[model samples]
Target: MSNERLRIALARSGHTAASLAQQVGTDPKTIERWVNKGRVPRLRNAHAVARVLGVEVRHLWPTLNGRSEVSGPVGSDLVAVYRQRSDVPIETWKTMFDQATESVDIMVYAALFLHEQISDWNGLLRSRARAGVRIRILIGDPACDAVRTRGEEEAFGHGIESRCRLAHMHYRPLLGVDGVDIALQATTLYNSVYRADGEMYVNTHIYGMNAYGNPLFHLHRMTDNGLFDAHAASVDAVWCTARPLTGEIPDGSD
Candidate 1:
């Protein structure tokens, strides 16, 4: 029986037998056997192949579920840590955006830097969405109490709310696009989440400090219950309560 899942994943990731085998350090014939005969690779090779294919090991071989073990300590999910979000290189962010295959989820109060600092933020998102990636964006409601308090805490006065409005304006064009959903969240955000598939950047919120100045954790999902799962759950919770963005935010409002 042919391994349809492996074949589809290879197609979506633009990898053929020769290319995948070369990256996985195996012969092209072995890769062919895995697809043509449904032969599962060894555990180590399975993980290596999944990593290169930007997917979970179990996703390609369902029978291997619960058997894949993480080699490091409990904090193995942590890939890197930055003293501040600004410390992370721009190229790293771009690479993350480009490599995502399944989904891109972001929840922030007012991540103006994504647009102002990141080159072609809007264009990247649109291109990703066109590639059938599910995109969920949750921006803070500018008129909500949470936004006002966050502004006061950060000593931005009403500047934070203004920034939120500007973010809304920048994202307005994506409202009607397929595979993209934007919403207004009123929750008092404790951490801002920026996720691409199984990897994420978590910006910890600190009182009286700007978000960009706070510590940021880069995590990749490894175990079923890990730091990555915790942050991913928070994103889903907020997304459930967030109201869908319907129209534009008028000027001089709130």
Candidate 2:
């Protein structure tokens, strides 16, 4: 549990070992021992130190909070947390965008941002597939009962169908590229996923609001009991029940 974090916190708080020792009711030598010798202190002392430093105890020592250190294939528990889907940083999205060399998978209802916000995203996918990167995109079936229900419940007008079709329009050119596949699914999805080979970003939906306002979780591949494979498997299951996109849209917008 002991690491340089204590020292760093003390530094950030502009408090020397002697001063922090005084604040936490510890001897100056004890503080030095913890900082220099990597000695972990009792919970009481840890709490006192964290209180003085204006940080949580877990922030200082993650293993102290009854949770063991996260260890798995990718060697961490979570990648990043976002309050909403848009809260995910552009750099992070670009990292996922530029990193996939083997495959890319997507399962979403109305991922308009992919085409509207991301510059030439589908075009890049085409190029990647042309270079032998397999890609699969699964969109919600607008004609399905679930999509109509979600739209009526959320009052998003009729654009759910339009957005899905438009997104497909963006990907239509990729149909000619080998290894690229697009489909429509009727699965009831609470979360939309964007996955590459090793990592994924998940956006959890909240009823009566749009998907953009939902919480997001970033997961990475791990050896066991990791969310990466679990979510990926869920997407695969939905994909299995999905139908291939025929580029036919009832919406005249596209």
Candidate 1 residue lDDT tens string, 1-254:
78666786687688989999999999999999999999988999999887787655655675664544245554656666679999876766776777778999999988998998788898899999999899999998988888989999999889999998999989998889999999999999999999998778999989999999999988777667788988999999999999998776734354
Against the correct fold, how does model 1 do in TM-score?
0.72
lDDT score, residue 213, model 1? 97
Error of 2 at 154 (Å): 1.7
The true-versus-predicted C-alpha distance at residue 181 of model 2, in Å, is 0.5
Q: lDDT for each of the candidates?
A: 0.85, 0.75
Q: How close is candidate 2 to the true structure, as a TM-score?
A: 0.68
What local lDDT does model 1 show for residue 240? 96
Runs in model 1 lying further than 4 Å from the true structure: 1-74, 250-254
Q: List candidate 2 stretches off by more than 4 Å.
A: 1-76, 250-254
User: Candidate 2, clashing residue pairs?
Assistant: 73-223
Clashes of 1: 0
